[model samples]
Structure formats: structure tokens, C-alpha cells
Target: MDSPTILLTNDDGIDSPGIRALANGLSDVGEVTVVAPADNKSAVGRATSSEARVHEHELGYALEGTPVDCVIAGIEALGPSPDVVVAGVNQGANLGMYVLGRSGTVSAAVEAAYFGVPAIATSLYLPGDRWKTVPKPEEYDEAVRATRYLIERGLDNGLFELADYLNVNAPAPENGRTEMRITRPSSVYDMTANHDGETVTLQDNIWQLMERDSYSEGERTDRQAIVEGVISVSPLAAPHSTEHHDALDDLAAEY
Candidate 1:
């Protein structure tokens, strides 16, 4: 049997240390090809450009497009489709339901899921004060460990049988070998907007709260797990969750 072929990508550009770490980590599992954005497309979600141009390089392809664009181009325009799609080891963590729609790293995995491909999306949670300072590739050991573990066990064991994709976030290395937890996205959102006569700015404080041990629920949630320095793995589906609503149907009859 042949080794699995893995397609790797990220919201950060191809040169990002996060993706590089991920690629190197997965090298032992299979042949890895990385196709990523030419520049940082963080928080762009699944946005794509119909007119975007692509540039080819020795390592992979770079697009003047979003993370979803890279996945589409990788499968449609690039060679031999991969066995699985993996995104990120992103510079910042992507947690909660509120962020799912706005995160390019998660969007890349979602795009793959829509195509019926099992996928993994990874991120590193950095402290707010140090988020501006880039970390070294060696620092990603835990994230890489979790990612490789998923790749090694997820496919062969049918871990993705019930999920369209996965969202994984690792605490900064200081938190030591974080325990793995199966979780659902937390339903919390924090947004602050400020206006000064002429200009307006939107700020999201969710990451700040995510870093604090006091604010998180001690249960096995992504936010809480990362705060405790453990790896968080969340199984996710592509479409919105559905629930039977016979009561709502009866209410509609009155109209």
C-alpha cells in the first residue's frame, strides 16, 4: 500500500513558520504538498476570488486569494488530488462558533469538507502581548504532535466518519503536553466598536478572554483546554446543524 498523500495549506502565507512546521511534521506520514496564500489572509473565512492570479513555486502554489481559493485551486488546478487536506498551525487560535464563519484556517478545512474530503485545521494560541512577536518553528512541537496524531489515527480509524472536518488548537508550549479533548465550539462572542467623530474601529476581545484561566469553563472545551495547556480537537460538520421542529411547523399553520 502507498503512503497517504497529504495536501497542506494555511491562512498564513506559504513562508509562515506554522505551516512549515506542519509540513515537516507530516512528512513521516506521507508525501506532503503545501499550497497556501501568498500573503496573510487571516479572518477571511471561505472567501475566494474569481479573478485571482496564481503563482507557482518550488514548494507549492501561492495565490493572490484567500485560503479557500488555495484549496479550490489545489484540487482543481494542481496535480493529483490528495488523500486529505490539512490547514494551519495558524499564528493565532480560532475558537468558538462566532469565529467559525470568519476564520480563513477553518474555512479552508470547511471548503475541503464540502468536497467530501476529510480535513484538519490547526492553530496555536498565543498570548495577546506576544501575538505580535513571531515564534520559532521548534516551538510548535505540541501543535505538530496533535496534528500528526490526527493524521495517523483519524483516517485509518475512521475518526472523521462522523465529522466533515476537525478544528484543533494548541496552547503555547509553556502549557506542557496538553490533553486531547473532543469538544463543540463554545457559543460566545465579544465585539467592541468605537467611533471618534470621523473614524470607526471594530475590535474583538474574544482571544483575550480565551487566554485567561479564570474566564474559561473547566469542562473539556477548546477554549478551556487551551487555557490549561492541552490540545483541543473539535469535530465539525460543514452545514448548519439541524433539529426537528414539529412545534414550529404547527405555529406556521396559524399564518
Candidate 2:
């Protein structure tokens, strides 16, 4: 059987070390075409561009746009139709339910899922605020290994039959390869907005909570799994979750 054709992209820009490491690792198992942002587009989830410039890259192509734009161009114009889309080996971990929609890495995978393609978003966990500094390419080995393991068997094993895509987070190589665990995105929310006399500063307090060992997410969540030194793979559907509430139902009926 032929190896899968992969659409590889990242928000860390075409020249980022994380994507380069991921591209090299994936080549061992598939034909990898990288269609990534020409500039770092981090935290810009699912944002698109009406038009983007394409550049020839050593691995594939670079786009002067968001990750979603890269996915579209790769599928529609710049490359072959892919059997799978792999985003990241992102420089920082994308964990928690609240954070997923804000991650360009995960957003790329979500865009692929909408295209009816299997996708996986991979990232390396860097504790605290240390994630602001990108890790060395060698530090991505654990994340690369986990993603490869999934892509090697996921399709044949009926993985995508059950889920649209996967969000994978792994500890850095200092912890070596750990066990893999199936997890859900945690519901923990700790965003805060502080208005100084002049400016409003937004902060994500979840990491601070973790540092204090006070986080409330249980063991089966992505955030906690990484805290315990294991790879977390959350099999997720592409659409935003919806739940019917009784109060809303009553209000509608009364109206």
C-alpha cells in the first residue's frame, strides 16, 4: 500500500524549527507537503484570507496567510489532494477546551476535518511561561513520535471513523516517551481581564493554577494528562459542541 499523502502546516511560520522537525519526522512515513504561513500566525484560530501569496519552499510551499488559508490552498490549488492533514508539532502545547478554538495548530486540523480529511494536531508541552521561547528542534522528538504512531495506524485501525481529528499533546524529550492516554479537552476556564488605569491586560491563569498545584481538571483531561507526564490524544469532532438547556427551552415555549 502506498503511504499517505500529507498536507503539513503550522502557525509557527514556514521557517520555524518545530515545523521543520515535524516535516523531517513525517517524511519517513509519508509524502509530506508543507503549506504553512510565511509569518508566525500563532493563536489566530481558523482565520482565513481572501487572497494569499504562495512561495516555493524546500519541503512544500509557504503562504502569506493564516493556517486555514494554507489548508485551503493546499487542498484546492498548491498541492495534491491529501490523504491526511497534520498540523504542528506546535512550539507550545494547546490544551483545555477553552484554548482549542484559539490554537492555529488545532485550527488547521479543524479546517482539514471540514474538508472530509483526517487530521492530527501535535504539540510539545512547555511548562509555565517558558513556552514563550521556542524549544530546540530536538525537543520535538516525543511529539513527533506520538504523531507518527497515530498516522501509521490511525486510518487502517478505523480511528477517523470514530472521530474527525485528533489533538495531541506530549511532554518534551527530557521526560522521554511516556504512555499515551485518550483524553477530553478540560472544561477548566481561568481567563481574567484586568483593567489598569490606562490599559486592560488579559491573562490566562490556568497555567498559574497548575504551577500552584491547584488546577481542578481531573485525570482524564488533556491538561492534567500532560501535567502527569503522558501524551494526551483527544479524539474530537469538528463542530462546536451544543447542548439544549431546559431554561432556554422553557423561554422559547413561553415566547
Candidate 3:
């Protein structure tokens, strides 16, 4: 029997060490093809460029576009559609409902789910104070380990049987032995905007709180789970959350 084909991608560009680690880790399970942005796309979410370009490489294709574009192009124009799509091992963790619409890593997986493909989006959580200035690839071993474990076990074990996609976050290795936990996205949103002279800067303040020893009603959430040295897996779908309204039905009937 042939091994499963996996299409791998990330928001952090094709040359990023995170993707390289993921590719290497997944080598044992299947044939891997990496298609990702040529440059960092990070928080761009599902945005796509009409003038996007693609460059073929020995490992895979690099796109001058958003993470979503890479997945779409890989499925439609690249070689044989993969059995699953795996995005990231991103330098920073993508957690909470607030991040869902702004994370290119998760967006790539969400895009794949729309096509009925099982997908996994993985990221690493680093210490907030040092993350921006001291980011390093060596710190992602635990994240890669979690991602590899998922790919090896998730498919055959029916984890993705009912899930369209999964959003995974692993803590930095300094946190110690990591445990895997099924989790949900947190609802907390802490962001700010400041104007300095002529420019306005947007900052996500939640990271600071996330680095603290305590969290607010976030124990089982992705953010808290990562802080506790655990790999967080959040099963997600493409369906829009809905609510039934009898008032709307009555209004429609009166009309």
C-alpha cells in the first residue's frame, strides 16, 4: 500500500526553519510536498493576492501570496491532491477566537477544510517578552514533536473523522515535558492601538498576560494549555455559528 500524501505549508515563508523541521518530522509517515509563501505572511489571515506568483523548487512551490493562496494553488494546480494539508509549526502561537480570523496559519487549514480536506495548523508559543526580539528555530523542538505525533496518530485514530481541521499549539521547550490535550479556543481579546507622532501601532497585549503564571477562566483553552507545557488541539469546522430565532420567522410570516 502506498503511503499517504501530505501537503505541507506555513505563513512564515518556505525557507523558515519551522517548516523545515515539520517536513523532516513528517518524513516517516508519508510523501510530503511543501507549498508556502516566499515571504512571511503571518497575521494576514485568509487574504489572497490577485497578482500572486509561484516558483517551483526541489522541495515544493513557493508563493508570493498569502497562506490561503498556497493551499488553494497546491490543491488546484500542483501535483496530485494530498490526503491531508498540514500548515505551520509557526514561530508564535495562534490561539483564541480573536486570532482565528487573523492567523494565516489557521486560515490555511480552514481553507483546506472548505475543500473537504482534513487539515492541521500547528504553532509554537514562546515567552512573550523575548518572542519578538529573540525568536529562534532551536526552541521549536517540542512544537515539532507535537506536530509529528499528530500526523502519525491523528489520521488512523479517527481524530479527524468528524473534524474538518485542527488548530494546534505547543509550548516552548523550556516549559518541560509536553502533554497532548484536546482543547478549545479562548474568547479573551486583549489588544491596543497607540499613535506615536505620525504612525499608529497595533499591539496584542494578551501575550503579556499569557506569559503570566495565571489565566482568567482559560484553563482548558489553547493559550492556557500551552503555558502548562501541553500541546493543545482544537478541532474546528467551516460552518458559521448560528442561532435559531422565532422572532425573525414571525416577522417573515407577517411580511
Each prediction's RMSD over C-alphas, in Å, is 1.8, 1.8, 2.0
Clashing pairs in 1: 178-230
Give lDDT tens digits, candidate 3, residues 1-255. 147789999998898888988888888878898889998999998898776888987568988999999999889887578888999888878989988989999999999999888899998877765546435667777777877777777778887887889999888778856788898999888889999999999988888886676655567888778778788999988776778899989999999
Model 1 C-alpha lDDT versus the unseen true structure:
0.86
Whose TM-score is higher: candidate 1's or candidate 3's? 1
Candidate 2 weakest lDDT stretch, 10 residues? 208-217
Q: Write the per-residue lDDT of candidate 1 for residues 45-99, one digit (tens) a residue.
A: 8888986787886667888889998898888877468888999989988888889
lDDT of 2: 0.89
lDDT of each: 0.86, 0.89, 0.84
Backbone collision tally, model 3: 0
Error of 2 at 139 (Å): 0.5
Which ranking of candidates, highest lDDT first?
A: 2, 1, 3
TM-score of each predicted structure versus truth: 0.93, 0.94, 0.92
Which stretches of candidate 2 lie above 4 Å from their native place? Answer: 213-216, 241-255
Badly placed stretches (over 4 Å) of model 1 are 250-255
Ranking by TM-score: 2, 1, 3
